[model samples]
Target: MRATTTLFSLSLLLAVSARNTYRSVLTDCLNTASVPILLTSTTGWADEIEPYNLRFTPAPSVVAIPRTQAEVQSAVKCAHANKIRVSVKGGGHSYGAYGLSGTLVLDMAEFQTVNLDQTTKIATVGAGVRLGNMANKLFSLGKRGVPHGTCEGVGIGGHATLGGFGLDSRLWGLTVDTISSVTAVLANGTAVTASASQNKELFWALRGAGPGFAVVTSFKLKTFAAPAVNINWSYTYSFPTPAAAATAFQIAQTWGQQSAPKELGYGIMLFPGNAFIVRGVYYGAKAKYDALIAPLLAKLKTAHGGVEPTKSVKTLGWIDSLTDLAGAALATPARGYDAHDTFYAKSIVTAESAPLSFEALTALFTYLYTVVPPSSAQWMIIANLYGGPGSVINSLPASTDPSSTSSYAHRTAGYVFQLYAYTANSLPPFDADIIPLVEGMVTAMGEEAADLPAYAPYADPELGQAEAQVRYWGDGVARLKVIKAQVDPMGILYNPQGF
Candidate 1:
């Protein structure tokens, strides 16, 4: 017994000594650098480390906030030398915690800078810049804008790389499509600029598969003149039965068959109370918007049978439109990053090739109304019209388009259906069952559409890694794997669903 106890004591001492040695090395390396390296026990640790989605509270050993490109390179090199895994946190909005799990986290929040060149109509944005701030800044500077995400808190890094969609996505392309160049740090801690003329292959991968290959520092993106006016319209139709709700969905799908005007952005939301809400924004004047939607509204009313809808139309400036798109609370400048509540979300892209049938819509509505548990927090289904007439998404065939070389493969999808369940609890007890339920809905939708694709940014953890990759990348997976091998040959940068 004494011998065994001594052996255990010696092992414990060795482990402690090794851990202390590692800490010393890491501290020494960071102290010599220019950025701030925060320890887990530091006072500001919680504030700096908290992700947008409270569900993922990562307890990384250290968090480094680099303010410059050189500092980012140094931090990556230091992490590599110390044999510590590094994860980059931009806006900290990765739903699946893709930005958190690592021995060291490179928090890019301090690198928030948006510089616009009026002559070129291009914006050079830091990876950490949030969409709302960027949009406001651009509008103030020169009434210029780039396609970005709807959520104000979403960061440029993940959104642009994965696929950034917004109210203007149909008119302009995705945010990634607007990127003219990218500045990133490779696995070997080498800083490189990727653009059409420089590191072409790296640029192709950086635009879409950035997280899987390198740490992006900044992006030079093309900007467009902001629209003068944005007209918002909404109509809510309450259904008494699942059949009525399903019929409304069918009519909406039929309307979707005809290419929507490029100037208009449209979507639908289904709430727990058997309510289907149709909401849209027209970039032009209110009169033109009315002329475009009037016929569709008539057809929808006819399809809705006896249901009467509460409808409203309002026109606002571009900035106000952005505020309207994101909830009023989120758009509030005072609302801090920590204000966002914990949430679980899943999404699937529905293509025009295989639309959701009426039977499938009814079944989905039934499941949502009956099987899904009701919680104090909000949960609902959102279907966004991601593709239509003016969408440059599929303008060129995937085989020939340079933009298609990136891993975002759902360009052909007409709409993206998202299932979001929000809660205050970071670790909800019902997560186990809830996750599967959400995945089941996606599975059913995929089956209905003969195996359609999923959006990568949503990043569903419930979908097993292999299946998630197939869903996220589709045929692009093969090319992504080849590039992954070439860039991150050491397999340094990685995430569960990454290349």
Candidate 2:
């Protein structure tokens, strides 16, 4: 017994010694990487690691802000040499805070450079550029645009790579589909551009499962013409009963599947009070929008005993429309963006063929109205329209071979539901009810229970690694793993839910 105990003690000592050796190596590398690096317990360390989702507070050992491509290569090389797990934070908007979860963080803040080719209509956006800033700059450059989330603070790198969608997505396709190529540094510190022609396999994995593979520096995206006349419209209704709300929701589902046009971007936002709003923007002329939407409005009023909605509509220019949607000015400062919130979110993508049953819809409304906390807590359910006959999002395959398509898992998704709950307080260590309430509400929707897929960007931090891998990537997980082995065999670019 004494000998066995001595052997165990020796093994433990050896493990500690090995850790100390690598840590020493890592320290030297960060100091020499020629960039501002925040180390744990240093002056600005705590603030640097505070992520957008206050629910998570990851204590990364180092936060390296690389200014140039060469600096990025050096930081990644050091992490690889020392066998430290790495994460890249583009905007730090990850719902699970995975962007801040790694022991060594590559904060992509200083990599903000945007260049556009006018003739080809392609924009080379830096990974650090936020969505709203990208839209504003592209508009200023050549009245050009790309599909992206409405959240102004979301970073372009993670958003575009992880299946970005927005009011204009059903019209232009996802932000991933707009990508032509990407410049990335691999685990081995080699910078390469992946596209249809070069580094083809890496391109496929990076579109949907990007964060796990490498440190992406910039994205080469296909741009579109900003419409001259954009219309912002909304209809708010207060339903007397949950059944009434379900009836209106079902009407939206039917119209979205059959009658809605690609130019018409819309969704039903449900509040905790059981009141809801069917709101969106139209990309084309106002007269045409009125003609196209009149039928749906008529149908909505006819359902649930002639429910009438309060309406609001206005015309705006390109930048004006985008700014309104963003709810803030569509421009970012050079640095120091600290927008954050304390919230829990769960998302599911429902397919075109498998629409939600009326029973499930009714239950979802019932639970929200009766079971959710009072008006004090803030919560919202956004059922965004993603699939229709005119939408390119549904036309593509999930991911296939022989040139290999994008790995975005929900090409057939008709609606992506974001069930979110937050406390009155902005800082986290939130009240206990937030998680159960959000999860239970999502469960009542019956989409995931029906085996519909999950969205990778709005990841649930609570899920186990294996379960999240399948839900986010499905069968594509195998190909992603294969690519990871080929590029990141050391598992350098990793998050908790990543392969």
Candidate 3:
């Protein structure tokens, strides 16, 4: 028995020795690497590893803030050499806080370059460039902009890859669809360009599910001409009960499926007390906006003796329109992010072919307003129109709609529902009821239609890996895994629900 015990002790000692050697070697390599590398023991590492979503506290062992392509390659190579997992932090706005996941963090805060070719109108944007900065720069350089999310702090790296959606996406297509090419460092530490023609498979994989593949350095985006005249419009309607609000939402779903024009981008923002606002931007004149919007308002009035909503509309230039949508959250800092939320946010994308039935909508809203959610915390729901008669988002792959054959699988997303539960402040003491209340809203609808899937961009960390895979990627899981194995076999580049 003593001999056996001695052998066991020896084994344990050897294992500890091996681990110490491994970590020491990695430390030597990263410390000598030609970039800023922060060890967990290093001063200010705590501040550096802070997550944008205060709810998630990912403990990365090492943080490498790469300023140049060479530096990125160096950091990636160091992690790969040490067989450590690497997660890239761009603008650090991951709802799931996946950017600070894994053992090593490649924070791309210094790669802030935005160059727009005036002739071709092609913009070369650094992966680290936040959406607001990119938009502001693009509009100033040439009256050009790429379709992106409302949060200016969101970096293009994950946002574009995870199906970047915005008000303009219905007409312009998603931010992923704007890519002409991407310069990324693969798992093996070689920097290469992935596009439709060059490294085609990689390009296809990167478009939709990029975080699973490589460290993208920069992107070449095919920018659209910024609208000379942009119109912003809003309408507020109140209902006696949540069920009544659901009736209005059902009317909205029908309108979104039947008549929503591509030139129009809108969302129905639901607030407490059964109050909701149908607000968005139109690409053209106010008269045209009113005309296009008249059908919905008329239909609403006809239903249950619904009264006309309080209306507000304004016309603005390109940049001001972005500011209006983004409000004051557009200024994203480079190094450490100051803005944060203790929140739970998730999304569901219903197919255009399967608009939410009235029964399903009622179950969702009624459950939200009456049964589950308490008055302790704040909550919001927005059903944004992504598809209808002529939306660019509905353009399938291999089609002539300029929607290239990429991994983005939500072409049929008719209405993308965003559900959020949060505190008024950035600090926690987050309501325990928040997640269940938010999740049940999706589950309520899914109970009506079991095949309904969640959106990949607004990733929910509560989901299991297998469940999230099916919900996020749907039919593309097998193919994505195949490509992920091809490029990132070591599985260094990873997130919780990533391929």
> Top lDDT: which candidate number?
2
The per-residue C-alpha lDDT of model 2 at residue 262 equals 84
Cα RMSDs, all models: 2.8, 2.9, 3.2
Task: Give the C-alpha lDDT of model 2.
Answer: 0.84
User: What lDDT tens digits, residue by residue, belong to model 1 across residues 310-349?
Assistant: 9978798888888888875333231256655567778878
**lDDT-better candidate, 1 vs 2:** 2
lDDT of 2 at 411: 74
Alpha-carbon runs more than 4 Å astray in model 3? 1-21, 304-306, 372-375, 398-404
Tell me the tens digit of each residue's lDDT in model 2 across 1-499: 9999999999999997986677668878877877668767588677778888887878777788888888889988999998899898888899988888887899998877888898999999998999888988899899999988888889987898888988888889889999999999999899999998889899998988888787899999999999988999998887778788888899888788787788888888998666688989999988999999898888788864586788988799988998898888878763667788889888877888877777888888888888846335688889889987688787776585454469888877788888888877767668668888888886887654445678998888877888888888888888888998999888888878986
What ranking emerges by lDDT with the best candidate at the front? 2, 3, 1
Query: Any runs in candidate 2 off by more than 4 Å, and if so which?
Result: 1-21, 401-404, 446-450
lDDT of each: 0.77, 0.84, 0.83
For model 1 the local lDDT of residue 186 reads 83
Q: Please report the candidate that would top TM-score against the real structure.
A: 2
Q: In angstroms, give how far residue 115 of model 1 lies from its true place.
A: 1.3
